[model samples]
Target: MKYYLLALWMWSGIHLANAQQAAVKVLTRAQENRILVRWGVDQPLEWQRANNSGFILKRITIKRNDQLLASPEKKQLVRLPIKPEPVESWMNLVQQDHYAAIIAQAIYGESFEVEDTGEQSEVSRIVNMVDEMHQRHSFGLFAADMSFQGSIKAGWGYIDTEVVKGEEYIYQVAVANDASIASGAGIAGLNDFEPLPEVVDFMALPDDRKVMFSWGIIPYKGIYSSYMIERATDGRNFTAISKTPIVDINDKTGNASTAMYFADTLSNNDQKYQYRIYGISAFGERGAISKPISTQGVASVSTPPRIHDYEFKTDGSVLLFWEYPKDAEAEIQSFEVAVAAKDQGDYKIVGKQLTVSKREFSYSKLEASNYFKVYAVGENNQKIASQSVLVQPIDSVPPAIPQGFKGQIDSLGVVQLSWKANAESDLLGYRIIRGQDKDEDFIELYDKAYPQTHFTDTLSLKLSNKKVYYRIAAEDFRHNISDFSEVLIIDKPDVIPPSAPVFSNYELANSAVQLEWINSTSDDLNLTVIKRRKKEDVNWETIASFTDLTTVFWDRKVEKNQVYEYLVMARDEANLWSNPNNSQITIAVFDWSAVEVIKDLQALVDREKRVISLFWRSVAKGETIAKIEIYKNKKGEAPTLWKVIHAGQNALNDVDLDINTEYQYYFVPTLHSNTPAKAISLTVQY
Candidate 1:
């Protein structure tokens, strides 16, 4: 008896499958809290699977590009901890405390919770993505004398369908709406299924005033080869919607279905709408409605903003901000900010929901992606469109290059360089540097770092006289840099004359004054400038220019109590000026006085240490010099110099052999131009 009862219960449940759908009641939004839900618990019990294949609770989804949502979308896949159920798989790590914003694909990082994990509510794990594979069905519709337009999938195999070429199938349609929300006569499939009936069943329609509608068709065998379909409204009074006779399924030579379907792309959005399918049989019969579907109509609310403001702030952090959109009617929850590289691909969403005021957002941690744009949404709800905002961020540009750079060779074989002006904002002066030979390091020969780019390069005995190369680059006030221009090379000479001499001190005697200078190390060096100023004057006056000096020279006759000043310049065979050297003096009224002159000069001796051949020059070589002296500042000792030479001559190398200690020398040039004295050719090593 118990077995019989169980079998009867199972059969009853199978027969009541469609009735299970009626258990859930659809209610109007106005009466949502008091929804009328019915349960058939005593009739059938839900069987629980011992495995992991049940239900779960989750968050709602939001979609973009479509105003209507189709249940749940992936963006709303919630995360919550649960003990695994199949239907609740979408909920995994998200907990009840986790709050997230709901958004569409367009807005970037927006998400919502899927569900909470508790007793009965569990997060299901995915076993496989492609666990279910459905074989492709072959079918298409053909018009059996305008009866039915058939099938669903691809067109193929038709060898076994025992239908005739002229057999007909009936199609039908109906429309309905919510009784409380719309409050009108709900519609349903009008005409009953008949064997090619001649007229539509108008009385079966619920009413004419309604919002939603539905449609479908039924199949039936026929003998004629022709049929015509008629369409109607409110599932009533007949009227044909199509002008031509659609194909039939029974007469199809290839794969085909005798059923037909119709989709509505166009409808009045202001008012709710519903669509129904219709089919005509060769004998004028119609099928019952399949299902009723409603359109998701929408209304346009606002126009996009006319202008957008993109502000860039250079604080410790670089911030990108924008203004609110204009002409927005509805409150917006977020905006999508896009960024693109300066010279690269399209702008993509970098951030979103920066704010909720329909606009105004900021971004930081910026690097190379400089170009940017913004867009606005009307509570996008992930459906409608996003308005746009446009603005440029870059302000002042970089400084331009210097106007002109020209170089010319002088009679002394030195490069004379000059450049024009840079009129842009706060461009400090420029510096001139030179690279001699091809592989030598560039050196600066200017007195100051920010000197104008104009310079005169006198060949130095210390540097090779090959091609001298140079170029110029600019640095703006903001330290923005311009690259270097092409290089310019100029040729130099091989040799130069001796430079102007210098005297450390001078004094006046009863009728004579003496002068001396620290010597040099160059082999072919000569020439000097003598400067003098008589009394209180700010201007420095040159007394005379003396050339072809041997070493130090002395002047015998002079007036009493005369004060004077003198400076010198050195030169080589090429007549290039080295650097300036100077001297200062005060003479007594009438008295013979010895002048301390030479202080520091150079002396290089050969290995043999014989025949001291000294090389040095003086500022006032011809002036009266009671004596000349050379000195060196050693570590932890008083300065030492060559002995006082009252003979008025620079120190020559000596072979006196003092290898016990290291020694460096300073020489004074006791120079004379007219004296054919073989010029003391001595190589001093002491």
Candidate 2:
């Protein structure tokens, strides 16, 4: 009988184990100091099908230190009222103590189902369509009203209880079927999860002798909490400035409708201030602070001084002067100077901060990009800046006055000046100056500064037999002129003279010697003088004088068989004489003797042959015969007309004389130049 009873009890325990919901989760509400319990079954449809009945909840508590309090014996059970809708807020419990443990239970039927309406209703069809669209199983309107009998399912649940401040508590929970069969118990202590709300919209505004701050309040959701304000000189790195948190009413109004205000007293008015506010919970938990805000105390601000004049040198030096307003509001403590290469480039400080009383500044040996600006600082530490100044260094020192100055004049009276180039990096140009005399003041040779070291004075064309002095000076890019260079004296050249006349040809006549010569080629020649001397004479006599262009000369006084020497000299307009250096031409004048009469002369004619022949002997001294003339005429006509036919020949033959006609021929011999010889006429018949 005992074995039978044990078997029956084991079967019932197995049945209860097969029909149970998941264990419940318990949470403590930090916003309300209340306990909230929630539980759900993993297979609600299967549980309803098996039990066909609703769940029952059970809760109980045990206080370890409060033994005088009546401890609940047999867990207090409460039947969950059947409702048409499923419950999300399974349970809510309030407890007086700030500390306690909670336990809970849920019992439900193993099988149950909602009664189905046995008709095709529009509401049912709509509900089914909605379920399909959502991809979820349809739950009947009366599904929560279903209950279970005999307790087919069982599972643990939870009840939240507030815990005493700084105290600890433990709790246990279990669930049983309608047959009183129980599951394992769950245990936990009260836990708080809610955190304090963050303070919103914290700000700092500048005010005289103080910095005012305001922030949005977070309505007390749990216990009464307060706000703590913090401050920092820099934007970051803050410390609590308000020793106590500013309190607010814990009423139901939202923090959005209210804002908390505070002022951090200032020891001085010259520094920047940053602020933030934090929400402190009643439990001493501090939420995150609001985002930081910064401000500067009120003070008069002024515009920076203006730079009125500035200069830059090629040697990397800068000079600057400025002017500032003298009004009382423009009071300035100091001035700051900075330089940069470009508009947006990082600027480096020029030097130590300067007093406002000093209106001028200078810098030297700066060798980078040159943009600059100055800032005026007020007593409140606020700064205003001036317009940027571009520092472009200019070359000031004139070049080492162009060394090695020299001038030259050409044969055409052109003056040329040359000198060494200036070594200055910024030398702009050179100037050439000229003076008529070495000691006189020089005038500019050119209308403008000469761009090169060499200068040709085109306007100094009258530089004949006169001295001209020249000097050079240099100017820099900034028009800094240098002193004149060493003097360069150039004397007009007199090197050119009339060219010597060349003897081209000579001819001797009876009473005179004819001479022809090439004219002197010098353009400046003034006159030509012809001189003559006999071989026996010791001195030369002037034969003729002619102008500079004359080329020919005549010497009418001459004797035969005499050797005479002749030469020509030329003079220029400068009174310079041509040096012959013994250059001269000599010639001998002579007369040729007359030729003698012809000897052994004969003439013959052949009528049938139509030929005629003549013969004669030449003069014994052939050198004395310059030429012979032969003349021919009709036998009777030529004797009167007497034309010469042949000369200097010993024989002559004439042919084709008219048939049966007689011809006469005259032969004459002439001396070299003096006279012709007697003529002989010959008659021939053919």
TM-score, cand. 2 vs. native: 0.30
Model 1 spans with C-alpha error above 4 angstroms: 1-267, 275-290, 306-310, 314-327, 331-334, 342-345, 354-358, 367-369, 379-686
lDDT of 1 by residue, 1-686 (tens): 00000000011111122333212111110011211110111111121110012112122223223333455342111232112222132123122101101101101122211222231122111111111110000000111112111100000000112222222211111011211111111111112112333212211122112222222223333322222333333445444333333333323333444443322332444443333334433321343332332333333324333334455676533444445534353544455667655435576777766554544556664542345565554432332233333333343454566557778776476678877766754454565566765477777655443536677777654464545787665554445445555677776554444433557655543465566665443555555555555555567665555565544445554445555445555656556666653334543434334333344345565656443345554334445544455444333345566455655464465554444344444443332332111111122234
Task: Give candidate 2 misplaced runs (Cα > 4 Å).
Answer: 1-491, 581-583, 592-608, 612-650, 655-686
Question: Candidate 1, after superposition: displacement of residue 108 in Å?
Answer: 61
- lDDT for each candidate structure: 0.37, 0.55
lDDT of 2 at 537: 83
Please provide, for model 2 over 160-265, each residue's C-alpha lDDT reduced to its tens digit, 9 standing for 90 to 100: 4434432223332232342232323233223344555565667776655677777665354333245678888877788887433454422212233366677777
- By lDDT, the best candidate is 2
Clashes of 1: 84
User: Once model 2 is optimally superposed onto the true structure by TM-score, how far is the C-alpha of residue 222 displaced, in angstroms?
Assistant: 99
